[model samples]
Structures are given as C-alpha cells and as structure tokens.
Target: MPLDRRSLLLGSPFLLSGCVTSPATQRPSQAAISRPDMVEADYASIYAAVDGEPFPVPAIDLQEIEPEFLRRAVGYRTAERPGTVVVDPGERYAYLVGEGGRAIRYGIGVGKEEGFNFRGAATIARKAQWPRWTPTPDMIRREPQRYGRYAGGLAGGAGNPLGPRALYLYRDGRDTLYRLHGTVEPWTIGTMVSSGCIRLLNQDIMDLYRRVPVGSRVVVLGSGGGTAV
Candidate 1:
C-alpha cells in the first residue's frame, strides 16, 4: 500500500483511563474522500480489474462513526488490559480493549488460510494515505490471473486497491505479511478476503486510521494463527 502524507483523526473525545476529554469532533484540514469511477483520466488510478461487470458496494448493516454500536461481550474474558488490540478472526471482530472493561471493537476481514492469518502481537510500525499498492510477489504468484495487471506497479487513487489508508504491522523489526488498510470494494468487509492483509471499509478504515497512532500494539488470532512481535 502506498501510504504517503495522508492524515485522519476521528472526531469526539477519547474515553480512556478515567479521563474524559471532549469529543474528537474536529476534522483535519484535508479530509480524504474516495474518488468516483466515472471521472476522466490522469488521477493515479489504483483499482483491480474486474473479470465481470462491477458490482455496487453492498449495504453494510452495522454501527458506524455516529451512534457507535453497543456491543455485548461474547461471554469472553481476558487478563483485562487496556490499550491493546485483539483480533479474533472467528468472530470477525477487532477489540480495542479500553478502560473499565470497555472496548472499541470493529468488524474486520481476514485472510482465507485457516492458521496462516496474522495473530500474536505487533505495533503500528508505519502508516500512509492513498498509499501506493504493491502486491507482494507471492500474491502475484498465487493469483496471477487477478494480479498480473500490476506486473510492474500501480499508482495511488481511484483504481488503487488500497482504498484510502494503510497501517503497516511489523514484528521483530520485520515486515509482517499483514496490513490494516482501506478497501475499495466495501462489500468485502466482514468477510473472508485478501491474500493475507486485513481489510476494512474505506470509510471505516479512514475513521480508524485517524484515531490510532504509530506503535500501538496489535494482537491477531485465528486459523493457523501465530501472534506477531
């Protein structure tokens, strides 16, 4: 993913650590918005080619930025710590466990391989916006039919598959074959998608990327799951 200088910050107060700040309602000077498909040329296209006709994004029924979903604990317990991200692929939920047993959880899309999905612990090593997407060689090899279009490289923007933002996950100072990034095909959210990367709706990711900071710890679990550094 080509993460450049793009920026995002969710509005409203961050409720944490017994301290209540004002709602983080302030938008950045440059709010990123997805481009339309019907526009003309010369806009750094970054979309994957469709084998058939393109389908409109499906209507996702879930809580969005406003009126955040009131989640019920899945009868799950933990050592009970905050400031950590735990991803449970079986539940398709990423819980940002917060103070007082509260968590800001969101639905996520995971990899297809059972145990090969990212798990363990890591941090937000880096992040970018409208990031240039370079499909890993393995991804190309796995699905040449789908990825051959970018045998070379693809710029960022409309056709770009990385959507709007990309948060790179790293462990042991090495690149994990995983990423938290925006999805152009919003319908893919809450489904088994991606060769390995974790995906979110463009709008949702845009909202998340803005709230999280670099070096935030993340723990992934599922399939042949092994936790990251």
Candidate 2:
C-alpha cells in the first residue's frame, strides 16, 4: 500500500517538524518527516514555503517584533484601547484597542483602491493551517487571469500564498467576504495591497492568530462594522 498525496496533505496539524519554512516550495528536507494520516503542523515549514529566501544582503533584521514594530503596524482604529481589533484605513493601523486607553498595535497591508477595497465588520470565524484556497466566483469573474487557473481550488502546502495559517472572518454568521490571512510578502506589512482582505507576515499573523480564536471579537472601524472573532 502507498500513502496518497492528499492523505499526506490533509493529515495531522502536528505533521510538520519545528521548522518554519515557506509554504511555496517543498524542500527535500520536508519529505523526511513522518505522518499519522494527518497531523498538526509545526508551522515552521509553512513559513519556508511562502517566505522569500534570505538575500545576500539582508533587507532588515525584522526577526523580533518589538514595541517599535507595533508603532509601524497598520490597521483601522478609532482610539487606542484594548477590546477587539478596529481597523482604521484612514490611519492604516489595526489597533488591538487596549484597555485603560492603550492598544496592542500591529501594522497591516490593506487592499488596493476600488475593487480591491472592501469595508465591513466581521469576526475571526475559523482558522486553518496551509489552508486550501477556493477563489470566490466574484474574484474569478472580476479577474479571471488571477483566479481562473485555480477555479477547481488550491490544496494546502507550499505555493499557497495563504502561508501557515488563516483567520477567516465572518459577519451575520456568514463569511464576511474577507479574511485576515498570512502572506509571504513581509515588506507589505503596513500598506494597502490585497483585495479587501487583510494581509500579514506569516510570523505576525501566526502570532495574532494564536492570541485570538473562533468567536473572538473583531471590529473593523473602516466604514463602521463590528463583529465577534
């Protein structure tokens, strides 16, 4: 008997070893790991896949996200106070909206203008590791070149831009037509760059995802929207 490729993918969350590689290419080193049908991913491999290789001249250390980094984080917010995230596009900072008039801030990458921009309130409905991608029909219809190829859907693993994890957002108990997902493009951390979906570095998004869970609260101050994450 032979283990199918799908089985290898849909296996356990702990399947990956503690090696955070990008989710774009499967290096030979990855095949060495074992599988229990499907297991929990160590998350390291996913980083390797989507993350660009370190260059000869490192752009920026950016290894550790310090308080200064928070100052650079972009998202929507009204005032600084702990509660839920309230993304304010006008300011480009996703304020964790802290308590006692403070917020754990994080820079964010927003969508481009027009079709790429969307405003609404939602919650972190669900999450996944190396989540498969099935572009919405609207996305395909709007830009077939970018999505027609994957109409059937994209499987989890290296090459999927969603990186290590995904924080699915919902509104009115339905997918709010957006997501706060991880990306390999780390430099885009604090800018508008997606189709209304919030993008974060694999490391940062992973960090945020860990802190929040399904049903957690999220308030997108952009265009006045709020919900539970």
Candidate 3:
C-alpha cells in the first residue's frame, strides 16, 4: 500500500517522555474573541498560496477546517515572557506568548498516544526550512516494509512529512527529538494523530517561523497541573 499521511505521522520517530493525563479547561478569554474586523477575505489571504519557496504550498480550503482551529490572537494567562512558546496538548492549541496577557494561538495536532507526548520546557535550538525526515531504528525494525525504503532519509519537499518549516526542540543543549513542525494535512489540526511532534498548518508554521528565532523558550504544559520534563 502507498504511504499515506496517517502512516507518515503515526510512524514518525520521537523520544519517549512523560506527560500529564488530565484534561485542560482553559478556553480563550472573552477579551480574546475572534477579530470582528476580519472578514472571510482576510482568512482567505491569510491561508493563501505562496510563490517563493523550494516547493509550492497550496492554499488551504477553510471550509474543510473548523473556524475555531484557525490561527488567531487570544488572551492567554501565562507567566512565560514574550517570545515564549507554550503548547497545551489537551486543548490542541499552541501559544506564542506575547506582551500584556496576549498571545498568538495556533491549532495543533498532537501525538495519538498519550505516552508519546513530551511535556516540559525546551528551547528552539534550531530551525529548518523544508527539513529532511528519517525514520528511527525502532520504527524501521517494527515496520520495515513501511519505513525500510527511506532508511537513507527523505529529502525536504512538498511531499515530505515535515512540510515547509520545522522548529527543533532541545533541553540543556541536548536534542529531545521533538519538533514543532508544519503539516500538509491541515484538517488534522485540533486532533490527536501524530506520533509525537506538535504539528501546525503549513501557513501557520511559516508565519510562526518568521516571528520566532532559535533560542526561544518552549513550554509544553501538562493536562492538569503544569508539569515540566
């Protein structure tokens, strides 16, 4: 059978880590409601296709996605400083902390298995545009027919699972093997699907890439209490 998005995301490699199992309760504050000034055309432009890249990123069909999962600014209550990245897996959301209780929020697709999720603080040690992807030894061992052909690694391109950009996460100068990356499967946002990586829409990740830099802090919150790895 040909490899599909489900195969690619579910079989992707990630280092095992602890995560909280409780559900999240916080929603966007009333102050952070959707911008009334933003019309349908605004969303169209926001998810529009781009021209300058190694590969063409097609526009997203908004109708295919729930409006709640679209990118937007929201009122977030957090102690993290501006430029910090906070991921709440239970909520299927990620926040780019900003000044004055505000944050730019993006919908995210997390690991399907709770045990596969990594909860803790990390740093954006590296960033890549259209990064390469390689299945891990364990993944290959378990599913050789699915991952064996790509032992040499898959190149960055439109067909690659990492999509257009990737933010590499690390701790204490060591790679954690977790990533905040883009996905071509836009409809997967706000769901539990990936092996472990925190995935965002290609357009959203590209937008985040422009604003965040290497060395930025990242905090992945636990389901109930905010726990750190």
Query: Would you list the rank order by lDDT, best first?
Result: 3, 1, 2
Candidate 1, residue 93: CA error in Å? 0.9
Locate the minimum summed-lDDT window of 10 residues in model 3: 17-26
| Candidate 1 lDDT over residue span 1-229, tens digit each | 3212121011222111101111111221222222111112211111122212232322233333222221222223445356566777766666665555455555566664554466678888988876666645654565576445655766657556666678888999987857787665454456655556676755446546765778888887644432221
- Candidate 3 residue spans exceeding 4 A from truth: 1-41, 224-229
Once superposed on the true structure, which residue ranges of model 2 sit more than 4 Å away at CA?
A: 1-83, 142-146, 223-229
* Per-residue accuracy of model 3 over 117-217 as CA lDDT, tens digit each: 88899999999999887767776676688668877777788877778999999999998988888886788888887778888988888877877889999
Ranking by TM-score: 3, 1, 2
> How high a TM-score does candidate 2 get?
0.60
Error of 1 at 26 (Å): 14
Each candidate: how many clashes? 25, 55, 0
- Per-residue lDDT of candidate 2, residues 28-90 (tens digit): 133322221121233344324323423111122355333233332223234423446666554
- What TM-score do all the candidates reach, one by one? 0.61, 0.60, 0.83
Query: 1 or 2: which has the higher lDDT?
Result: 1
| Top model number, TM-score | 3
**Candidate 3: clashing pairs of residues:** none
